[model samples]
Target chain A: MVKVENLTVRAGNFEISDVNFEIPDGKYGVLMGKTGCGKTTILEAICGLKNVVGGKIFVSEINVTALPAGARGIGFVPQDGSLFTTKTVRKHLAFGPRVHGWKREKVAGRVKDLAEDLGIAHLLDRKPHGLSGGERQRVSLGRALAVKPGVLCLDEPLSALDEDTHAEMVDLLKRLTAENDITVLHITHSRREAEQVADLQFRIEDGKVVQM
Target chain B: MIGARSDKPFLAAIGALAAMYLLLIVMMLVADAIYGFGVVPFRSDNPDQVSLVSIFSQKEVINSIKLTLYSCTISALLSIFVAVPTGYLLSRYNFPGKLLVDAILDIPIVLPPLVVGLSLLLLFNHLPTKDANFEDMLNDFKVPFLFPKGIEVTHNVLGVILAQFSVACAFSVRTMRNTFDQISPRTEQVAQTLGCSRARAFFSVVVPESWRGISTAGTLAWTRSMGEFGPILVFAGTIPNKTEVLSSTVYLEITTGSLETAVIVSLMMVTIAIVVLVAVRMWDRRNEGGLYHG
Candidate 1:
């Protein structure tokens, strides 16, 4: 569960005023907007990457406004599929659990299980340099989900894909999040992806959130 | 399409350049042999004593070479530690006097070694140092090894390291800055969202992503340190067994009319340079296909 009360952020002269929202646990909440909205800024502030001018953010009822980005249990995927070049897919998946200090045996089994489910089992040995667009996105999603985060924050996860692949990705995401009860705060201009996957959708125009 | 033939001219130019470089290497290798032949008549060693060629095999030559390696290795490591972070900071953020810091770093590359040595001489001695000048305390007491033995950075291996490090660190910082700049900072932000700290994201994501370019930079730094001469000579001097490096050794031998030993040391230095430069070029070739952190 996550809640933002009177969230206000100013990136130079740009200000997002009175941005308030509440995400119930396991709910797939989507931030739907036309373009140039406060969607990504809200996401960044929630993760503590950017400081809020005025507001309180809570992760599972714990105030996390002042907390560091790493301390907040949110898994994120950006618009671009930014995978590590030097690491294999398996090692990329091992990143979060390693940060949290999971044992070697535990990390291996967990990575293998996730790789199998994501259908990236064969691609695990490969680097990100030559992976196909869909394959890279799958790897990005797997990296985010590998840690089993409390909230999954995706900023236009399929924005960079082709038309056919974008549709395919939306379907795959719906199927993957079906049973995990992962709270998702997705930012997108695409109404199709937002409508297809979200239980509750909000349009963020300028800096305020309005129910659509 | 029509552009296929257009690139042929550029390709031809590159091929010609490669051939010229190869010819240059062959010429350099032969120059030492020619110099050695000219100086063979000089009284090197009688039947009782070892030959001049065997001077390279002597414990003094061997030990100086090893010490040179030691100095270069430690300096390179320290430079990377200090400079990599500086590079990342320069690439990612805009801060006060960034241009001034950049201009200062560029000085060592263009400046003479003697100037670097002289400047370091001032800093180690008493000449308006930043924050804490320890010269006052050192004057009062003759401290032992761990402490200062009465102001002694001139004519030492440590002075040599400072000189080489200033130049080598500039190269490392410039290369690594480009590497980090090429990486999209969005990836690190994403990692941060996934419960990875800022330091964690740097180590786990950015560093690994830019490792190939970073390795190439390190190779360049190592080769630069190996070929280091001027600053070492002025600051560290051509000490018989203590401070003499390969380059300085070659210089000393040539000046003292021991041309055979000079030729041998120069050959060895060239060989090491070729190996490292080739390795760096190989790394550049490997990554050119956009494979490793392009």
Candidate 2:
């Protein structure tokens, strides 16, 4: 569960003002906004990547607004897939476990498990450049889930993809989340994508969420 | 009255220039081919003189090559550690003196080698060996490299390393900072929200995304360090077998009238350069061919 209240972020020559929203545990929430409406900045502020001039963030009941992005326990997938290009798919999955200090065998097992589940089991040896867009998104999603965060934040995950693959990826994400019981807060400008994946919808216009 | 026009002269001029350029290139190839190996031929009759096999086989020459390798590698690694962080900070965050840092970094990339060496010489002067200001500062710190005072970072291999490190680092940092600017900071934020520590997020997410540019920067830095002549010669001195890297070693050999030895050393440097070219091509392939396509 993630709760963000009175979130305000000030960057150079731009500021996102007075944003408030929530994604309950195990539910899917989508934040829809047109370009430059400060959607991504909200995620950055919540994760502590951007300094919030005013706000509070609670992830699974702990106020983590002042904490660094890494301490927030919110899994995030960028629109670009943003996988580490240097590592193989398996190695990428293994990264989260390594950061969390999981044992070698445990990491290996989790990677294998996620590979099978995400249908990327065959591409374990390949790096990000070799994967198709859908394949890459799956790997990025798998990498985030492998960390076992309290909430998963996906920023425009399926935007660049073609229609068929986009639908497939949406379904794939739904199945993965249901299996893991992960709460999701996905950002998108596409109303159709939000309709496909969202359990609750909030629209951001000029830096404020208008619930719909 | 009749008028005629032809593109002949312009085409001919272009063809002539092309031919001349090709000839110049071939002449370089010929020179490389002719003196590439020593004048002694494959087998020579002078036991006093070191043959190709001997010059190529000498532990000193080999050691210099190996030392060049180690020094270049160390310089590049150290430069990346400092360069990447500094470059990222400078690129992403703006504060007072940012422009000053940018100006200083660009100096090494533009300055002539001789000027650079002279500047390093000035920096190395008034060693804390006898300087009161540096001596007092040294006493406050507990580094072992200095004597009871500041002793020898200059006139030693350390001096060469430092000189090359600073110059190469500046070049690399500029290139790397551009690479960092290309990255979407959103990627890092996403990684952090995924429970990655700041250190881990940088290592896993940001570094990998920018790996190609960083590798190219490292290569450029290393090649510059390897080919650096004036600075090492000025500050470190051309001490035979110790501070003698490939460039200065060739210079010393040629000046001492060891023409054959000099030629062999030059050939060795060429071979090393060829190896770097092959490595760069392979690195390019990996960067383009593989993906975390996200």
In terms of DockQ, the best-performing candidate is 1
Candidate whose lDDT is highest:
2
Q: Model 2, residue B35: what's the lDDT?
A: 76
For all candidates, state DockQ relative to the true structure: 0.48, 0.37
Pairs that collide in candidate 2 are A74-B193, A80-B294, A82-B294, A127-B291, A128-B291, A128-B292, A129-B290, A129-B291, A129-B292
Q: Candidate 2: which stretches are off by over 4 Å? A: A103-109, A178-181, B1-26, B35-40, B46-74, B130-150, B178-187, B206-218, B239-243, B253-261, B279-294
TM-score of chain A of each: 0.95, 0.97
Model 2 TM-score relative to the real fold: 0.81
lDDT per residue as tens, model 1, B187-228: 898778777778988887888777776776787678888888
